[model samples]
Target: MSRRVFFVTCPKGVEYLLADEIQAFGLELVRHSPAGVWAEGDLAAGYRTCLWSRLANRVILHVAEVDAANENALYEGVLGVDWSSHIPGRGSFRVTFLGQNQAIRNTQFGAQRVKDGIVDSFRAAGAQRPSVAPKSPDVAVSARLHRNRLSLGIDLSGHSLHMRGYRTEKGIAPLKENLAAALLYRAGWPEIAAAGGDFVDPMCGSGTLLIEAAMMALDIAPGRRQDGFGFEKWLGHQPEIWLELKQEAERRAHEGKRARVPTFAGFDQDSRVIATAWKNIARAGLEGIVHVEVRPVESFTRGEKWSQRGLVLTNPPYGERLSERRELSTLYEALGETVKSAVPGWRMAVFTGAPEFGKSIGLRSFKQYKLFNGKLPAQLLLFEVDEANAMTPRDPDRSGEIRPRIANEERASMLRNRLKKNLKTLGQWARKQGIGCYRVYDADMPEYALAIDLYEGRVHVQEYAAPKTVDERAARERLAEALAVIPEVLGIDPADLICKQRQRQAGTQQYEKQSATGEFMTVHEYGCALRVNLKDYLDTGLFLDHRPVRYWIQTHAKGQRFLNLFCYTGAASVHAAVGGASRSLSLDMSKTYVNWARENLALNGADSGKHRVEQADCLAWLAEKPSPDQRYDLIFMDPPTFSNSARMQGVLDIQKDHATLIRQAMRRLTSDGLLIFSNNFRRFRLDETLQSEFSVEEVSKSTIDRDFQRNPKIHRCWHIRHLS
Candidate 1:
């Protein structure tokens, strides 16, 4: 039947491209709107459009268009349409309404009226009326009420096309496959391929980008692998025409030149993600073109001439999953430097939901495109290699100009003056404690530009400010006035210090005020063990508060199997292993810290096999088999106070889940196993009545650190014993 069907749809920013795709299916565009183009075609054409259009969300095929001045007219006009031809004989049907007008002020009311009109039309035809189905429907009707006019249509696409059916493996915050493809198209990949440039994603999670790039480069249609589409079940289904289209699509795909072998590569630091990427690459049937590898971004090396005009596209992880904000920030900074230093003239695109966080990379963007990543508005920031605009050299220009040496002498003069005045007060305090550590004095008094940290044999200094604060400038001036005799503050070198302005989370509306340094600083204490300077680490770095429990392990660890849960840098494991434990198992979700724990074991030269580290979801792993040995004498569990990393199974609110977690740990304990449960949630109160399975004791006092004399409520530790 000849029908004036107006198709209602929205294209993803690329409207002209989608328009070209739609016209390819033999549909005629009669009119166009901002949201969609009005097209005239038969029900068959509508069905074909829905089944084949990869970019469209839902296809609404116009049933009837009528002018309705008011609500009653809208209902009656809709009822006049031939409902039997559009709807199924006896299956479910629904009316969904949208738009604004007086004829139907509320969408809910408009939908009800349309449903009633359809039901009335069916009833008048002497057929058992099909019931309204709220969820899925055999025949779904859409009603648009706008400007006192009513336009009704039938849904030809039952489900969104983004669900490509190949995404069996999902990591935290995975990008939609279609969306990833759209991003590649937007980033000028089509032209990049023509220019002989390659594509590389260092942080490729699941190989989505690499797969999409390969598919597009080889002219492979995304829908080639789908099992079914809504049009297959339609009354006007054209099997012959659909098969012809499919054959043509495959024919065109075969004629196209494939992407250069090894031109597309994806790397992920995680082994599991690399495996998932390989599976996805295989699923796309592009294993020959796309390569997946397990390697850190820092380890990525570009062969000679391979980097020229290359495209480095990466979606560096946001701090949301990895709470190591400080380290990630430094890592991003290193990445930017690597890009500038190593890959000169190469182009780059970084897709991130949080643009402000991108500042940590230290690279300025040239172009940014707003894109929707599944309701999350993200920016695909494009950066170019313009070396001329990069950061200036640290040293000022001294071109043919001779400045007074007294300025250097003046800096020395200032340092001496400051030391002389504060010598007995702060200096005596520092010297009495074996003055090897770098004495951090502001370089410029009013400028407040510098801070120096001393180590036993080496010094670590950092410039705190550039122009310098008034306090720093004044401090420097004061030093110049007093410590002139101190011989230029000898024995300190400038290279040992690190300096940068404080960073803040970018793109965040709330919590933008948070410090850039992060809430904690985790460091390796011995060779492989991690220690946090909690006081400096947003709170307390090293949990000196865990001393008593560590001491307990020293006594009970002999000839026992020790399991340190949520082992941060394996500090507790080090204590257990050092205490002569026969075997120790440390479980942490962070690979970074797991490696750190391995280092700790190597430092002590402990039996290598005796210390094992596993990176997995601690709760899920624990819920599985307990150690078959049932031989744990020291088991420590101290979870973070609170965190919301995407790596975690779910948000961990320690106060609410501590008791349950502790109870589970006790299950993994041997008959005489000691389950040490500790947390830094200061306001926490123990669940004194935990099922009577174990005896609990507060070991709060044992956590005290000898070095930390100021405000020692760093963390609270407890020991649990199961009495057989």
Candidate 2:
């Protein structure tokens, strides 16, 4: 038996799992790579792996490796290969080429060249050219190029091995068969089944895990259930040997099915999906082996006395949107409760996309296996369900400890260190530039939930609203610790320090005065003077994060007309006016803030006639009146995440209304003008249509100051210009 190199592809992050599965077949020579594994084995070894290996996407047999720098080189190299021996003349084939080079940037083009090379090789050898059959090819060729080197192989498995033939019916976001098998392998399902233990998937969408686990326990060959494999149609395939393997597999499957199998059950809350799971199980010929039923998390109960200890596995929904987090938090907490109350001393493998949700489950895990569910980076948390992991002392003081916690103290120490480190660097930069207002801390410590800044000599502190689950007394103590640390940390007096808590503000709540202290501190940024109100507003008159953006406006404002939309306090307008802009107009819904913007302009000594402020809902203003006919050469538009104001006709959602806003804004821009659009919403996504409508370039990195280096996503800024 002569050995040959074989490439087995799997999902990204599952290379180690696939390598382990391949090595189990005694292939001794297995190397793992991104999204796949490489192995060296004989024909029988390859066949056996294709039949038994569960975590592989495709088993490709290496034919030749070529040096191809361009498409022509690629075609010549492919033509040099003897295709007649690999496939008969007129054999229908399809080529799957991956990667790109200087000359070939498209996979479709590379695939076409490879197909041409194969056909030319057959025709050049005086044989009839093979037909191309993308639908159902007789021979499937795989090619990939990296650094001018190409690796060509013939597919031994017809389609991806993840299509294990049992799942003709699938639910939304259903787990692929190979991924499900990998989860079971990581959870020690085979070992548990070997010990007469059972298996359960509490949230099984369509019983993918149940069928795969049952197959693994019964030693059933995946290829046996599959209709046809690519090798069966290959010219190099040995029919006699394949027949023997098939017979042997059938006999083993029949015997394995009759053996003592582990009790397996799948439960889903959706009754509709339960029927689909049963249909898929029967399709896989596991009629009485795997049971499925409709069961909610709240109704889950411990298994009967005979089957109590085994593996509980599930792939629960991980909320990908911010709005879904609150609801999904409850779901995860409920899942944790169900698993804890139903099965103790059992091993559980919970796959979730959000690692934070794992903490809500109230159970701690000993190990986490990195895996991928499609393109999303995911984790397989292996938890040992017991009293030691989930239960502990709940406040020895009985009334929830109100003093400084050791954990919070340690975190505060770390935050202090981080702040000092940042100040040593940013403070020097700020002083060198003659700037007196900047951020010293932007949530350096997650537990502290505060951002500290320097307003002239005053230390302004902001505390984020704590979740309802947090103890109020403890939150206050933590706040006290932060307050005590800030003044001492910056050598500022306590009397000059201002502390405020940030809550959800809608409409004019941000503008309404919190106090009657109309005291405004004059601050200097980039040689421009501004007034900041620390006592009476949720935000200081100036946003420290947009300092660079303001400076950018200053540099680009010379001899250009500038307009600022949804402008808060008109920092950008002031910068534009300071830069000698011909004229500037700033708009905002807050009349109080509009007055503040004018004060900022006056403090800078910019012309009152050239710089003006308007109080209006920006969306309504844009739609209600036509712009002064493309007058502005420079504009800045940064909207809120969500706002519902009594002054507006309807609510404004940045993501939903950005397209219309930008289109209307574009109508007001000069032919040679630029628009700087920015927002601080972390999850904001720009409208795709804007990509073609404007010459858009991301300017977030270029405009980020040193203070925001660690938190680049704090704001998203883009520079948009008219297409020439």
Which candidate ranks first by TM-score, i.e. highest?
2
lDDT of 1 by residue, 621-698 (tens): 766667567457678888875543447655354665677688778788877667878776545677667647678888
lDDT by residue for model 2 (509-622), tens: 323655678898888888788888888776677888889999999988999899999898888898899898999989999788898899889888888788889898898787
Instruction: Provide the lowest-lDDT 10-residue window in model 2.
Output: 502-511
Which prediction has the highest lDDT against the true structure? 2
Whole-model alpha-carbon lDDT for candidate 2: 0.80
Residue 345: error of model 1 in Å? 3.9
